[model samples]
Target: MKTYFRLLSFAKPIEKFAIPYVILTLLAVVFNTLQLALLAPLLTTLFASGSANATILTKPAGWADVTGYLNYFSQQISFTYGPFGALKFVCGVIVIAVILGNVFRYFAQRIMEDFRIHTLLNLRKSVFNNVMDQHVGYFSNQRKGDIIAKIASDVGAVQFSVTGTLQVVFKEPLQLTAYVFMLFSISFKLTIFALLVIPISAFVISKIVKRLKEQATMAQHMFGLMISYLDEALSGIKIIKSFNATEAIKDKFDSENVRYSDLGRKMARRQQLSGPVSESLSVAMVTTIVLYGGSLILNHQSDLTGPEFVTYIALFSRIMQPAKALTNSFSGIHTGLAAGERVLELIDQKPEITDAPDAVSITSFNHSIRLENLSFSYPGRTVLKDINLTIPKGKTIALVGPSGGGKSTLMDLIPRFTEVESGRVTIDGTDVRKLKMESLWSLIGVVNQESMLFNDTIFNNIAFGLPDATQEQVEHAARIANAHDFILQTEHGYQSNIGDRGMKLSGGQKQRICIARAVLKNPPIMMLDEATSALDTESEKLVQEALNNLMKNRTSLVIAHRLSTIQSADMIVVLEDGQINEQGTHLELLQRNGLYKRLIDMQTFND
Candidate 1:
């Protein structure tokens, strides 16, 4: 119930739709019930057509006597005009009642439809916004497909099943009450006998769908798992094919599919059972009511005339329609609530990293960035330990080391992408934690080994996060990164679509484009992680030149694998097993014949 209510809170200002829907639905129910209640008088008029007797009827004493009022008015029409006129009048009234009832119901449904759409729009927006705000590490621990399922599939399930039930919850019960009142006015004894089915039907149906919520929760989880499998298969299609493991991947996916389908079949069986079970119970109760009521009428122990008795049975049977709807809604809410719980769980999640109350924004970089007493670790393994370093303004510092040496992790700390475990990273003089994240990120640009380009036009990719960047500005950045000429050779130049992750471009071209994006941002500080490591020799020369252009006269931190690239760096720091093993100018490190020299010698031998 807590999760259900939290999900519903997204439908704020609900009264805008609720107030009008209630008024309209109430009006619709009244006329709808009147249409059925008029059946008694219509029958009275029909049976009396052969007789010319104008019987004067007494008006009922109270307003609750709906059947009495209908009978009195109907017979009065018979008394004034012939029985044929009364028949015409009653039929016209029934037709008008139906038309008005239907009109109001149509408008009411229209309002509810608007509410459903409004709720869906707000709910989806909230879920997506919360997801976009999470820190980088949060995504590392989560499955992308599972998050996607929560935002897409679970939210959609909530929109239809949960919000749709709001209409049934309000309209069905009001309708049911109106039907019950009319039945009682017609014959209190038979109505009481019919009403007993409520508790009996509820109890029996409860037993049938007792495990629906548990099964529904499990089904939602399995669906998320299946989506994760599909995403993995699509992302690794190349590797799967290269390894000749296509059949293995397919069989793995098929196994999950089979389990989801089987669980769906089970849930369907339970959900579908409630409808027929309630309907059958209604039928049995109706049969028993008819037998008892007919006995009363035949034995002359009751005051109900033949037409009124028939009217009672008619109204009694219609009660099951709303009852059946309520039962079905009860079953559906379990499934909706299950999906709602998943979605709400996401919305309730707070990001581990957020700006402090007194965090200030820094508009410019000055002096240097310093790491004091720095140490960091993952779940069990330390990545960086007791490391201290300083990067002054307008100097290029390169970090070269073996794999798992924490070079990339060191760069991430500058932009506050990963929080420090024990040490402080300060920009100029203030702690990075005391700086606003947006302001901190705005001062740095990054280019990774694997170029991260969206499936968009080259110009759009280059100008991302800078929506106001002009074509002239974009072209200038591209030229500096050596991407301008190749971009012009493409089908539409800068307007040409770069396929998914820039797959349509060559290795060098994609890296150059990524460099161009960084050049466009023109941050004071830059982090280049193996920018040219994946390219061929000719491509490497071009990209290395472009990297040189991007890093000129800027505060730069670079992680280079090729020893040749960083020989001219102002400072080169060597890390091994989460500790700084050497730090000096490239020539100075080689003179010392330490780790840096060994690395350069290995690459020299390989070349």
Candidate 2:
């Protein structure tokens, strides 16, 4: 219930929809019940079954005497307007009742539809926004596809379940109560017999759907797992084929598919079974009412006339429809609540990385960024321990290290992508934590090993997050990164759509385009994570030139795999097993014959 209410809160200003929906639905319910209630009086008035020559009746004195007033008015209409005139009037009334009932129902449906869309918009936006704000470590521990499933499919299910439940919750009960009132007005004894079904039906239906919430929760998780499998299969298709593991991958996905399908089948069985089981119980109760009421009529023990008895049976049978609907709604709410819990889990998540309450935004980069008494860890294992370093303004410093040496982790700390576990990373003199993340990230340009390009045009990709960047500015940056000539030679040049992650471009082409993007941002501080290490010799030379252009006179920290690339770096820090092993100018490290020298010697030997 708490999770449901939290998800519901996303539907803000709900009263706007609530107020009008209540009015329309209530009116709809009234007309619907009135339409059915008129059936009895209309029969008595038109057929003249018992009261063909009955006395010309007067209006009843009170509203509480519904049947008395109905009979009186029917007789009055019959005597004054003739039987045929009364017949026409009853027919016209039934038609009007139905039309008005349908009209109000339509308007209510329209409002609920709008309400559904509005809730979907707000809920999806909140979930996606919270996801985008999480720390880098969060994604590392989560499956991208699971997150996508929660945001897309889970939220979609929750929307329908919630809105449908809201529609049913308000509308169904009023309808049931209205029917019950009419039945009691006609025959209080019969109404009591019919009312007993409420609890019995509720108990039986409760047993059927008792485990629905748990099943629904499992169904949602299975869906997420299947989606994750699908995503991995699609993203790693090339690897699967190259490794000759296509069958293995297919079987893996097929297994999850089977599990999800089986679970869905089971859930569907339970859900579909509820409606029938409830309906059967309702029919059984209706049968019992008929037998008992017929005995009373035969024994001449009741005042219910033939027409009124028929009307009572009609109203009693109709009661089951709403009762059945309410039980079905309970089933739907279970599915919705299950999905809602997953969505709330996401919404309830607080970002581990966020700016301070009084954090200031930096405008310019002037001095150095220092890491003081720095240490970083991830649950039971330390990545960087007691590391202290300074990157001076306008100097190119390279970090050369073996795998798992925390090079990327160190770079991430600068942009506040991950929180500082124990140390202070200060820009100029202000702690990075004491500055707004937007301002901190704005001053740094990053180019990673993987070219993170969106599925958009070249110009748009280059100008991403800088919506106001002009073509002239983009082309200039491309030129500086040595990407302009190749770009213009393409199908649409800067206007050309780069396929997903720039798949249309060659390795060197993609790398240069990435460099162009960094150049376009043109931040004062740059973090280059072996941006040139993945390319062939020809692409390497081209990308290296672009990287040089991007790094010129900028405060740069680089992680280099190839020893030659950082031979000219102002300082090269060597890290081994989460500690700084060496730091100095490139030549000084070579002269020392230490870890840096050993790395350079090994790379040279491999070359």
Which prediction has the highest lDDT against the true structure?
A: 1
Clashes of each: 0, 0
Give the poorly placed runs of model 1, Cα more than 4 Å off: 51-55
Q: Give the clashing residue pairs of candidate 1, or none.
A: none
Worst 10 residues of 1 by lDDT: 48-57
Give the C-alpha lDDT of model 2: 0.88
lDDT of each residue in 1-607, candidate 1, tens digit only: 7877787788888899999999999999999999999999998888766556635569989788799889889888888997788899999999999999999999999999898888888998999999999988899999888899888888888988888888898899999999998988888877787777578988998888778888988888888898999999987899999999999989998999999999999999998898888988989988888899999999998989888898998888898888888888888888889999898889989998889999999999989999998999999899999999999999999998999999988888888888999999999999999999999999999999999999999999999968899999999999999999999999999999999889899999999999999999999999999988999999999999999999997999999989799889999999999899999998799899998888998998999
What's the true lDDT of residue 3 in model 1? 75
Model 1 compared with the native: what TM-score?
Answer: 0.98
Clashing pairs in 2: none
